[model samples]
Target: MTARATADSEERAPWLPMVGLFLAQMLMSFNVAALPVSIGGMVEDFGVPPTAVSTAIVTYGLMVAALVMVGAKIGQRVGWLLVFRVVVAAFAGSALMMVLSPSVAWVIAAQAVAGASAAIIVPALVALIAANYRGTQQATAVGSLGSARALSGVSAFLIGGTLGTFVGWPPVFVIVLVLAVAVFLFSFRLRSAAGNKSVDIDVLAALLIGAAIVALTLGFNNLNGWGLLQATREAPFDVLGLSPAPLLVLVGIILGQGFLVWTRYRTGAGKVPLVSLSVLGSSRERAAVYAMFIVVALEAALNFTVPLYIQIVQGRTPFDTSLAMLPFNLTVFITATLVVRSYERFSPRVIGVFSFMLTTLALLWLSFVVTNNWETVPTILGLIVFGIGQGALVTLVFNVLVTAAPKELAGDVGSVRGTTQNLASAVGTAVAGAMLVGILSLNVGQAVINDVDIPDRLIAQVDLDQVNFVSNDQLREVLTRTDASEAEVDAAVRINTDARLRALKLGLLILAGVSALAILPASRLPGYRPGEIPETLVARDGPTGPDRDRSTDGTVLEK
Candidate 1:
């Protein structure tokens, strides 16, 4: 059958296409949540410190943020359908490499490639929805995608913990590979839509963005280890001989960013710049973008810190921690889906403002109520409320951002949205991680100062440099074997508890402040209801005649 005929005659249910897209999106989303669950196993398998193992997560976020625009440009140059197929294949290959990775470095490399490939698929999927659906159909498609992402996160925690326990960390990659293959096969059934004309992509622009992102990420990652006030540090400021350079890296980031801005203006009259600062010239759109950045950053920080608090402070296993947080995701999925369907009945601005308020309140409550008391109920309840608020907030922002852009510029706007979210996640994780490390270090130092009865020689033999690498279990074992008095063990426990509680309080406070800032932009969101039909559509004036095309049944195409 001719392509036009097939497009018109295709009788598949609307939900079928949405389901396939959701599965594809879920595979990518699952990896984000799964990596945290397998962090311990990864450290053991690769024989690396926990901090080193975490580089994989940090690099994945950086790569995704850095390459999203490049990926979108490639899709527009090629066909979105073609790019989608290639990306799915690349994702599978990357996952396979990760499964067989022999070292931490190889694992990180594989993740980076997979992250970039995943970046390509996300914007393409959104573009596909815009091409294939209209009106309420398009809204439903977008909502399903958002809902699937939330549900995938919840599944990742549960599935990763279970699989990692029995089958080991490598099996997590294996599962991802299998899912990628399924997505690829399903995508083959997609009918090709109208192709996007090729656009010039500046290679130099891509490189500058990637370099800036890496430098910023590394700098933030090192902030705690290298004191912000310390200006003259070594090649990498040695924190217990584990080098983390904050200042120099941040300087490089600033320089690179400056270069990018200069280049953008220099090449302005030529082909369109990779990112047009003009988009931000719109006050409403700019506000929405900034709000998204803050909301994602806050969510990322809270997600990272809360799980650590549960496992380290409360002494829960990974499985128990995952289970404890399940309700948060459940609430998010349900509330977000409901909000998407009924959005037209309420104003987007009102919904967004209300959601941000709830999120801020939840964070503040968490900061006050989370102590060493192991109070799981209050924490869980707070998280559930936070999750619902976050889900509504994100969905509302995404819909507003995508719909507000000119139809011709949809691809560009989607690229910006994806990249901004990735960068926000990286920044949030790094900041929260640095704070946690700092809290741990201070507690360790205090414990050492309080120790009595230790001989001067024995005290000298104790290596402060090794303390950062020591796990809680290892610390307990060390104290047990040292012939220390019960008072010493008690002191160690107290120090650990105090450090964890302090970290949680500080992290939640940061989240609350950031979430509150979201209101400023959220209040400016277009006051339209959700699922409102656009007055115009892309390609609305394109040619239509018998010579142009006709369906097999000789009816004008509807899709």
Candidate 2:
């Protein structure tokens, strides 16, 4: 063998640094997953409604989405390693705050801090991986990030559920603190390029993008409460006669367009843009972004819907929620880790298409077979099938984006990925809730009007206009205060049960349709597979090229 080839064969990247990156990812995921698990404890402790606790979850996601672009630019200007370590320590502090929170307000504030820290950590993961690994090793590292996400989901649900049930909710966040500390210590092993002092921060671009993301996240999150069209009583404000939610969404879209226009102008003027548009320059890269958004959104919707059913509708415990979701979460973890092996055999285009097909079929199966009992054989099988698809797609689209960008612009790529994912998650969860509730309202209203057993007095006792998902037992309890006869109570309970099941089935069918539609974008993934894209093609959309230093052994180094 040639001397260079021999040297290359001998130089293997150590896997120790990856442990730190993995833990960093899990720290964020676990914190988010633990929120719902501890909702009951939080509600009891604070004497607030469950929606108050949910606001904390929304706050974290909104903060992350709003500031991630700015975070990426900051990381590039300030060294990634320095910023990463600082943010990891900050995350640890946030966990401590969570453990000692005196009120729901403090809990929200703690998550806000954690979200700000995560905004930096998200992009840092990509840049760090590029700094530490190359070729096959880099591919493994990228796939491991996806596995870490899946593994964290399972761990958070199982561990947080047990701890919250037996000990208390505060102990759950202690795990996050331990994880952050471990990541901080292990971070010493990672290598990063020096910060580029010349890189400019586009303040205008930051404001425009930040405002747009905030508006979009809030609009989507409040669609059900604020009203999808006309004004609802819960709406804080209205635009003319319509709900402010849709108006905010429209304004967000306009601001997003302005940001893009400003970015193109800035890039053409030879000034540093907030993010390099080159990340989305190619058709394949754009396709990867689209696929990533859809998959993440679908995953978020399922995560929200399943637990909402188990905990609220069926009145099951958090541990039961964990058990019901075990099959899907475990399958996702296994699939994400193993899918890297198939990259050598099948192209991204093939994998993307196949995965979408699997998701579509799985959702269709779920729509037909799912019942209130999530532990049923057919329901579990459907979840596993969906998990396989979700796992493969998550890793596949991420790898595609990672390979398409030159090492110098890895942070920008990371920012784009973060923005798409966070936005998609918000949209997915909002749409699912709105769609299901809307359907339920219709089903209940129609059933009440058509049933001959229902009397006007009983109907007047309930505010049909404020209908939402409630259990049969909850409905019965409410009716007890009224002079509802046994037959009337039974009728109301039957109507609620049928309406909820119908709504769930229809919602699943709608999600299946969305998965089917996403196949168009999946078809556009790269037709070829490579361990890593060549720098020549990656640099085609921008001025950046082979501008980084090379070691004496001729290995490409991060810049």
Candidate 3:
């Protein structure tokens, strides 16, 4: 079909399936966001530490990151529609498990199941969108995906907090079940495509990749608990008198490189690689992935940090946490949806760099503004500004990625997107937790040593080295047990407050530097303009000669 023909066909296209696809995306993101909100409730119900709940989040991310490439291959080998429907049913089952979970272990298992389902659904969304839409409609559909993610996060904080507060955390997952059913019921409206039987799934590469990601997540997740470089009491084991956390990270990097080498070997031998290397075949696509990882990672960091501060440190309700986060999350949703409107007026280079600059500035602003009290105006304004930058970058990078690749490889694109995003989320949350706690320990020790009010002899009595985020109330209770005077306990509380706040400010400043460095990658983003759809489509559908009718007329309708 020509431009006019494709536009006409798009107008006649059924949009009901897009709703199902959008909901599928939302289901995954909402569940991820819901985990943090439910941390307080889960800690109370299961009598486990917040770290235990944090494990469930990491486990889910690990599963998705490890299996998503294999999942993408599975979708191509099996028909996308068939695999999609099956996984949707599995996701619903996972939700049922969430509702009936008896322990933190059960919750982790349930999330792992959901992550496996999402691994497939993530890739299927891109493939399905490719199968169903073309021309400008396709661009809009892709852009809407970013908005769907932002919208899901917003809904999770609002709805999850409400349900976790009043009803319970289990009831919060009921929302996921509802969305799953809605997606499953409407999935029949999606266009079906034939499976490519010729493609082979590379199991060896899968194992290597899975192991690499598992190592990476475990390493980062335990950086605080296990120790960053030296052995702490919590270290499961040691590596040459050094901490295993950093060792695992090193091993993960080596294994990751091995996977790349293996893939090249397979490709050189004329075998079908698990994922297409061409997805990041260009410098531009590689840069897009790099930038996407940083933005998403920062987003994950903020989402985890803010909630942990409010609900855990401040001992506030989830509702209060939600109220504090609403401005930022709501801004992300609105900006993600609206960012595409600027595509025609501004190049992605301009938008990408500007967005990174905005995020960098916002984080700097937030570093200065954040106090123990997050409800203040300056902090909220900083959050809103950061959200706008975050929202725009996510959508913009995604669009650049999708448009740069051929439509036939949409599943590969989706798999790459899923892996990068889930892995980033895992790394981001882990690093944020680790960095803050690490800094707090250092600051606390220094405060204890330097302040005459907090004598060295008194600090020596306490295990100040194994520091973690504790409520002021909890700290007071601990200090009361110690043979300390009233003035001493008060000083300890003051020291804890000042040190924790100082650590957070330092973390934000470091993150601001990272955001600033990401401007380099953003500079390399694809420069395809919105109206360049004709050229992009031509690249996909091929020249308008012999294969014109067969390729263009029913490109999406092929079975």
Per-candidate TM-scores read 0.83, 0.94, 0.92
Q: To one decimal, what is the Cα RMSD in angstroms of model 3 from the true structure?
A: 4.5
The global Cα lDDT (0 to 1) of model 1 is 0.70
lDDT of 2 at 59: 88
TM-score computed on alpha carbons, candidate 1 = 0.83
TM-score computed on alpha carbons, candidate 2: 0.94
lDDT per residue for candidate 3 within 420-477, as digits (tens), equals 9887887898899989998998999888888888766677778977788888999999
Q: What ranges in model 3 sit over 4 Å off?
A: 1-12, 533-559
Best by TM-score: 2
Per-candidate Cα lDDT values, in order, are 0.70, 0.88, 0.84
Candidate 3 lDDT at 20 equals 90
Best by lDDT: 2
Q: Identify the superior model by TM-score, candidate 2 or candidate 3.
A: 2
